[model samples]
Target chain A: METVMLDTGISERGDMQKSRVKVGIKKLDLFYSDFQALKDVNMDIEEKKVTALIGPSGCGKSTFLRCINRMNDLIPGCKVTGDILIDGTDIYKENIDVAYLRKEVGMVFQKPNPFELSVFDNIAYGPRTHGLRDKKKLEIIVERSLRHAALWDEVKDRLNKTAMGLSGGQQQRLCIARVLAVEPSIVLMDEPTSALDPISTGKIEDLIAALKNDYTIIIVTHNMQQAARVSDYTAFFLLGDMIEMGPTTRVFQLPGDKRTEDYITGRFG
Target chain B: MTANDRWSSKEMILQYRARQKRRQAIAYAFMYLAAAFAVATMLAIIGFIFTKGISEISWEFLTSDVHDAGREGGILPIIINTLYLVGLGLLFAAPLSVLAAIYMTEYSKQGILIKIIRYFTSNLAGIPSIIFGLFGFMFFAKILGWSWSLLSGSATIAIVILPTLIRTSEEAILTVPAGYKEGSLALGATKWQTMVKVVIPTASPGIINGIILGMGRIVGETAALVFTLGSGTDIASSLMSSARSLSLHLFILANEGISTSKAYATATVLIVIVLILNLIAGWFGKRINRYKDAR
Candidate 1:
C-alpha cells in the first residue's frame, strides 16, 4: 500500500500504532447570519472508523458534516470560529488552500447528484479536474473506484451511457465512485441514503461497512437503525448541540445523557 | 352526519356544481379565445407577407449585386452586410453579456446593486429600437468617429441585443440544478471549474436559444441600422466601410418607391431568415426542456 503525503509535510501512514484520530474539532462555532447553526462542537474522529452523527431535522449534524470539507464557505454570511484539524493541520488557517483541502476530504450529498454525463465521464470528472489526463490511468481509476463502490458489475457495460439513465440507487453509487476516484482519506456522507429505497439503502450501508477499512467515514443520518447498524461510534445531536457521543453499542444500550436515551427510545426528538 | 345533510340539499348541491362548471367553461372559453387571437395574428402576418413577397424571390435576387439604388439588381451585398454586421454584433455581445450575467448571478452579492442592475437590464429590453439607433448614432457614429460604418453598425446591434442575451443567459444559468454545481464542488472542483464544466454546459442550450432570438431581432431591425449603418448599396470592403443591411435595403426600396417588387423580394428574404432563426431557437428550446427532464 502506498502512503499519501499532505502538503503539510505529514505522510499519512496506514500503521495501527500511530495516533488513531483522523479529525479533531475544538471549540467549533458556526453562524449563518444571525442564527447559530453549530455551538461549541468538539469531537475526535478515529482513523479508518465509521462515525455516525444521528440527529433530527435542523439538528446541525448535516451542517457539521459540511464543515469537514468547508462546504459552508459557499454560503454567504456564514461565519465559523473554531479549529478543525485533519491530521494535525488546521484546515481553516489562512495559508490552507480550500480546494486542496476539499480534494482530501470528499463529500457525498443526500440526493443522488450524478452529472448529466456518461457514467465513465462522471467517475473521471474528479480525476480530470485534479489534472489526471492519461486515458489508461483514468480507465483504471474509474474501474477500481466503481468496484470499490460495488457498482462495477451493473454499470460496466453502459459506462458510455449518460449517468442520468441510471436508477436512483445506481446514481448514488456512481456519486460515491466519483468521490472515490479522487482518493480522499476522509469521506463525509450527508444522509446519502435518505433519498434511496430500502434495498438501495442496505447496499449503501454495506458499502459503508466495507469502505471504513480504507477511509475515515463520517455519516449524518436521520435513521437511528442505520446509525446503530453501520457506525462504530455514534454521536447524538439536538438543536445545534452534541448531547452524547460514545461507542455505538454503549450509546445505544446505555446512553450517558438523558436526551440521547430519549432520542434512541423514540421518546422525542 | 350524512353527506347530503352537509350540503343542505341535493338540489342546492346540483345548482352549485352547475355554477362551478359554468364558471370553468367561461374561463376556458376566454383563454381559448386569447390564444386563438394570438395565433391568428401571427399566421395572418406570415400569410400576408408570403403572398405579397414570395413570388418576387429568385436565385438571382439573392445572389447578384444591387444597382440603381436596389431598383434593378440583386441584394447579395446587402445580405452579406447584414450577416457580417449581425455576426460581429453577436461576437461582441455574447461574451460580454454572458460574463455580466455570470458575475451578477455567481459572484455579486444579493443586494441593492444587483437589484438595480436587473432593473436596468429588463428596462433596457423594453426600450424602443429607435432609441437604441439614436444612442448608437451619438455614441458610435458621431463621438467615436466611426460614422455610418459596418463597425458602428455592429457595435450598435451589440447594444441592441445585450439585454436580451444577458436576461436569457441569466435565466438559463439560474435554471441549472443547484445539485449539479454542489456535486462538482463536493468533488474538489473549484467554483470556476464547476461553472465551466456543469453550469455553463447545462445552460448552453438556453443561451444559444437567446442568441438565435437576438439574431432574429438584428435581422428585422431597420431603424437601429439606419442611423449607424450608412445606406451605401455597395458591398462592404472592410469593417470601416459603409454598407446597408437587408432590412435597410428593403426599407429604402419601399419607402422611397424605388421598386415595390424589389422591396417585397428583400422582405421575403428577411422573413425567411427570421423564420429559420426562430425554428433553430425552437429546437434549442426543446433541447433545454429535454435536459431539464433528464436531470
Candidate 2:
C-alpha cells in the first residue's frame, strides 16, 4: 500500500512525478465592488501538469483561474492586490499587455459557447485577430487546432456549417478547439464538463489527459472523482482558504489537514 | 346558485341558464361589434374619399406644385419637398438616435444617469407633435436664424421624432441576447469590436423595424410641421431650408375647401408609401431572423 501511494500525485503517467511551478500566486486578495470575495491565498500551479482546484460553492476557484488571464479586469469594481506571475513575468504589472497575455493564456468556460459563426470561423477568430488572415494559412491553423483538440475528424467535413448546430459534446470540444487555435501556453477550464452528460464528460476527461502533454491545464471542478481521476496535483479549498494541496492521491487518501480530511470523507463541505 | 341554495327552483335554473347563455353571447357579440365598427368606419372613409376624389387624380395635379390646386400648383414640388424633408430628417435623426441607443444599452452603466435618460426619453415620446413644432419654430427657425428654410424645418421635424427613434432603437438593442456580447468578449475581442460585429448585426432586424415606424410617424405628421416648416409649396432649399410635407398639404386643402380632389390622391400615395416601407421592413426583418436561426 505504501509503495502504491506515490507522494507526488503520479499514479499512471510519469509526467506528474516532478515539475517546477508555472504560475505562482502570493498573498492574493480580491474584491468585487466592496464585497470581499477571495481572502489571502498563496499557491503554485505546476508546469505541464493537470491541477484541479476543488471547492464548495463561491470558494473562488473560478476567480483564481480568471486572475491568470486578467479576466477580472472586465468586471466593474473587481479589484485585486497581489502578485501572480506566469513564467516569472509579473502579470499584475501596470504595463502588462492584456491582449498578448490573453493570447498566451486561453480559457474554456462552463458552457460550450461556440460562436454564431461557422465552425471554421469560430476557430479562426483568435488567429485572425492576431492578423493571420491569409486563407490557406488560416485553413491550416484551423485544422491543426481541431486536430489537437481531437475534434478534426468529427468536424472536418462540416467546417463551413454553423458552430451552433453542433451537439453538446461536440460544442464543448469545439470550444476547446477554439482555445487551441490561439496556441496558448496554459489552458484554464472552469467546470468544462459540468454541463455535459457522462459520455461527453468522459470524452473531455480523455481530451484533458491528452492535452497535458502540450499545455499546462488548470481545471476548477466541483466533482471530486473527476479531480481524482484527471489531475496530477489537487488543491482542496474550503471557505476561500487552501486547506491542503499535494499529490492528488495523497490528498484523497491521507489528507494532512483535518478540514481537508473531513471534506474528502464527506463530513462537510 | 348551487342546488343547495333554498332560493333555487327548477324554473329559475332554466331561466338563469338561458340568461347566462344570452350574457355570454352578448359578450361575444360586443367584441364582434367593436371589430366591425372599426372596419366599417375605415371602409366608409375610404369609400367616401375615393368616390368623391379618385376621379380627380390627374398627372397634371401630381406634376404641378400649385399652392392652390384650384388655381395653379401641382403636387410635384410639394411632393418633392415632402421627400426632401423626410430624407433629411431621417439622416439627421437616425445616426444620432442609433448611437445614443447603442451607448445606453451596450456601453453606459445601468446607474442613475441611465435611469434619468430613460425617464426623459419615455416622457418625450408622450409629448404632442405640436409642441415639437413650436420648439422647432422658436429654436431652429428663429434662434438658429435658418428662418423659413427647409433646413430648419427638417431639423425641427427630426427633433420631433428623436425621442421615438431613440426609444425604439433602445428596444431593438435590448432584444439582442447578452450571450452574444459575452461570447465575443470572452474570445479576447474588444468591447467595441464585439458591439459592431456581433451585437449590432444581431439586433439589426429590430432596429430597422424601429426606424421604419419612426419614419411613418414623420410622414404622417401635420401639427408638428405646421409651425416648424414654412407654409409654402415651393421646392425646399437643402436640408437647412424650410419645407411643406404631404400631411400639411392635405390639411390645407381639406380645410380651405379647394382642390379637395388632389388631397385624397395624395393621401392614397402617402398610404401606399407607408405600406411599401412596412412591407420592406417586414421582409428584411424576416430574412435576418431566418439567417440567425439557421446559425
Candidate 3:
C-alpha cells in the first residue's frame, strides 16, 4: 500500500512508533451552541483502510464523520474544540484552507443527491470548480471515476443524459463517482446505503471494500453486518463517546465495553 | 328513553347527513358559478376586442407607420417600443432580484435584519404601480436627468416589478434542496461555487417563471410608464429617446377618441404578445423540468 502522507517532516518524534495515521483526532469536542455533541473523541485512523463508525441514531457517529471534513462548520452555532489532524496537519488551524481540506476529504451523503446536470457534468462539477477546464481531461476523469464507482457500464450510454433519470442505486453510485473525481485521499460515507435498497446496500458495500485499496474510507452505518463485512476496523460509538474500536471481528465477537456489546448484540441501541 | 325517541334519533342523524350533503352541493355550485363568472367576463372582453378590432387589422395597418394621431396607420413603432421597454426592464430586474434572492436565501442568516428586509419586500409589493411611476419620474427622470425616455421607463418598470420578482425568486431559491449545496460543498466546492453551480441552476425554472410574471406586468403597464415614459409614438432611436408602449398607445387612442378601432386593435396585439410570452415561458419550463426531474 502506498503510504499517503499529507504533510512531511513529521518523522522527528524520537521514541514514538511510526504509525501511518491518515487522520489523528485527539480529545475532540463538538458543541452546537452549548449542547455538546461529541465528547473527548480520540481515534487514530490508519492510511488506506476501511474504518466504520457504527451507532444508533443521534449517537454522533455521523457527526464524527462530518467533523473529519469540517462539514459541521456549515451548521450555524456548531463549534468544535481540540485537534483533528489529517495527515499530521491540524484541520482547525487558522491557516488551514477549508476548501483544500475538503478536497482531500470528500463526503458522500446518505441521500443520493446528483446535481441537476448531465451525468458527465455531475461527475465533472468538482474538477471543474477546482479549475480543471480541459474538455478532454474532464471526460477522462468522469469515465475513470464512474468506472471506479462500478457505474461506468450502466451509465456509459447515458452520460450525456441528465443524472436525475438514474435509479436510486445508480444515483448513489454516481454520487460516489462524483466524490472520486476530485481525487480525495479520504472518503467519508455518512450512512451512504441507509437510503438504498438491500441489493444496492450490498453493491455499495462491495464498492467500499474495493475503494479501501486506494482511498482511506470512514463509514457511518447502523447496519452491524455491513460494518463487519466491509470494514477492517470498527468503532462503536454511544452517546458521543467512542466505546470500542478494534479489528472488525474482535469488536463484533468480543467487545471490550459493555455498551458496545449491548448495542452490537441488539440488546439496546 | 322511549322507543319513539330512539326512532327519532336515527331520523335526526339521517336528516343531518342530508343537510350536510346539500350544503356541500351548494358550495360546489357556488364555486363553479364564481369560476364561470370570471371566465365569462374575460371572454366578453376578448370577444368585444376581436369583433371591433379584427376588421381594422390588415397587413398595411400592422406594418405602416401611424398617422393622424394613430387613427389611420399601423402601430409598428408602438409595438417596437413596447418590446424595448419589456426587454430593458427584464434585463435590469432579473439579475437584481435573482442576486438579492440568492443573498437572502443562501447567505443571510435568519434574524431581525432578514425579517425587516422581508417586511420591506412585502411592503414594496403592496405599493401601487402609480407610486413607482412617480418615484421613477422623480429619481430617474428628473433627479438622474434621464428624462422621459426608454431608460427612465425601463428603470421604472424594473422597480415596479422588483418586489414580485424578488419574492418569487426567493421562494424558488428556498425550494432548492439543502442537500445539493451540501453535496457540492462536500466535493470541495466553495459556497459561491455551490450556489452558482447547483443552487441557481436548480432554482432557475422558478426564477424564470417569476421573470415571466414580471414581464407580464411590464407588458400590461400603462400608469407607471405614463409619467416615466413621455407619450412619444415613435420607436426609440436611443436609450434616451422617449417612447410609448402598446398599452399607453391604446389608452391615449381610446381616451382621446382618436380611433376606437385602433385602440381595440392595439389591445388585441398586446393580448397576443402576452399569450406568446406565456407560451415561450411554458416551453422553457419543460426544458428546465428535464434537468430537474433527473436530479
Best by lDDT: 1
TM-score of model number 2: 0.84
> Better model by lDDT, 1 or 3?
1
Tens digit of per-residue lDDT, candidate 2, span B1-295: 5668778688999999999999999999999999999999988876776676667667887786675443455678777888888888899999999999999987888899999999999999889888888888889878888786677777877888888889878887776666566556666677787777777777777777777877788788888888777767677656555567888888877788766667777777667667787787788678657755644
Look at candidate 3 and tell me the lDDT of residue B276. 84
Model 1 ranges with Cα > 4 A deviation = A1-19, B1-6
Q: Rate residue B45 of model 3 by lDDT.
A: 88
Using DockQ as the yardstick, the better of models 1 and 3 is 1
In model 1, residue pairs whose N, Cα or C atoms come closer than 3 Å (at least 3 residues apart or on different chains), thus clashing, are: none
Root-mean-square deviation of Cα positions for candidate 2 versus the true structure, in angstroms? 5.3
Q: Which pairs clash (backbone N, Cα, C closer than 3 Å) in model 3?
A: A164-B294, A164-B295, A165-B294
Docking quality category of candidate 1 according to DockQ thresholds: medium
Q: Rank by TM-score, highest first.
A: 1, 3, 2
Candidate 3 runs further than 4 Å off: A1-19, B1-23, B282-295
Q: Pick the candidate with the highest TM-score.
A: 1
Cα lDDT tens digits for candidate 1, B103-131: 98999998999999999999999999999
Candidate 3 lDDT at B117 equals 98
lDDT of each: 0.90, 0.82, 0.89
User: What digit string (tens of lDDT, one per residue) describes model 3 on residues A89-164?
Assistant: 9999999999988999999999999988899999999999999999999999999999999999999999999888
